[model samples]
Target: MPKRDWITRLSTKFRQCQQSPFWHGAVALLLFYLPQTAGADLIAEGRAIVAEHCTRCHVVPEINPKGGIESTPSFKGMKHLADWRRRFEVFFTLPPHPALVTVVGISEERDKSRPAFVQEIKLSVDDLDRILAYVDTVKN
Candidate 1:
């Protein structure tokens, strides 16, 4: 069958299932459509933010970092989620970066060696929380 037809058939089946009052049907629907992790939404949003904002300067995340920020740490080899979680928690406790002193401005100190002078993207406390959760999921 064509892709559209297949989708239509599936939708019809889903509607029929929704009309059923069976506990098993409800359970099956819940499992089929609901996010497995409560944190899944935050993880996805975090991943997108990292990709869009950081990929040009930072290495696309991987198990190895052949060449990326030579001075700064890369997420490549960071295998310990617990450690990352702790580190991120520490980061939150500290004041935001000096460059970020003015809402989300960059430091005047430009380092060509690093991803220099990139303005801090303003993130809500909740956004930071979600980003950390996502990073924990992806780290090594």
Candidate 2:
């Protein structure tokens, strides 16, 4: 069949299904379940991103050995803080972060307690979103 005819047939079938009670229930179930699946996938992606970037300095769930420095808080621990979500939202723009990336280089007045060997790390907004989603799953 021609492409146009194939699409028209499919559309007609879909419209027919839309009028059926069975299809309505199926649609409702799909609508209810899809977001949960998407959320799970997003959390999984976030975990992977944390493992790739933050694991060097922060312990992340399910990544083994409880990595990161002793002084630096684990991802699970940080999640327990009331303001952690807000802090994480702006984490990349925070002080010492820009310096860590050599955006301006560390100033003498900067916090002296930070690890000297901490490397510059950069993440896309999507990556940050995923990491936050994963962090949300971490229990206190």
Candidate 3:
């Protein structure tokens, strides 16, 4: 039950399991590596994430040139990737969900005017990076 012995036993068990059932081995490998998928380039993943989350509020022209029901910030015209990277870097860093307060410092009135979806939208560090990568590719 030493740590090294435990690992050796675990490895032996894993090899035995793999020999008995290839499908189970494959599934175990998949589960082990699944979280690694988050590291993919932002442009591809970001666009998809934004399309699903942002289109409801903002006029995400990449997804829809015509725009959505509510009028929020125009991601099309704005320097979204750089702007958003900075915004999110600050938003996620502070404790206790200080995003609203942070937004107030930049553009208080404008923040108040944001669409409902925009207000509720939250992104993890990886997701934010991906979103910025996608937005950076988009030109006005």
**Per-residue alpha-carbon lDDT of candidate 1 for residues 17-105, written as tens digits (9 for 90 to 100):** 87778967788888876865556887888777656554444454642246456654565544444476676544533343433322222
Candidate 2: TM-score? 0.69
Better of 1 and 3 by TM-score: 1
For all predicted structures, in order, the TM-scores are: 0.52, 0.69, 0.45
Candidates ranked by lDDT, best first?
2, 3, 1
Model 3 pairs in collision: 42-130
Candidate achieving the largest lDDT = 2
Looking at candidate 2, the ten consecutive residues that score lowest on lDDT are 101-110
lDDT of 3 by residue, 11-79 (tens): 999888777878777888998877555444446788897788666656777687787655456676566
Clashing pairs for model 1 are none
Order of the predicted models by TM-score, top scorer first = 2, 1, 3
lDDT by residue (1-140, candidate 2, tens digit) is 46798899999999998899998899999999999999999999988877777777677666845567787777778778899899877666676455553212322333667643466565566777897898888776
Candidate 1 TM-score, true structure as reference: 0.52
Maximum-TM-score candidate:
2
Q: Which stretches of candidate 2 lie over 4 Å from their true place?
A: 1-17, 100-119
Question: What is the Cα root-mean-square deviation between model 3 and the actual structure?
Answer: 9.7
RMSD of each: 10.9, 6.8, 9.7
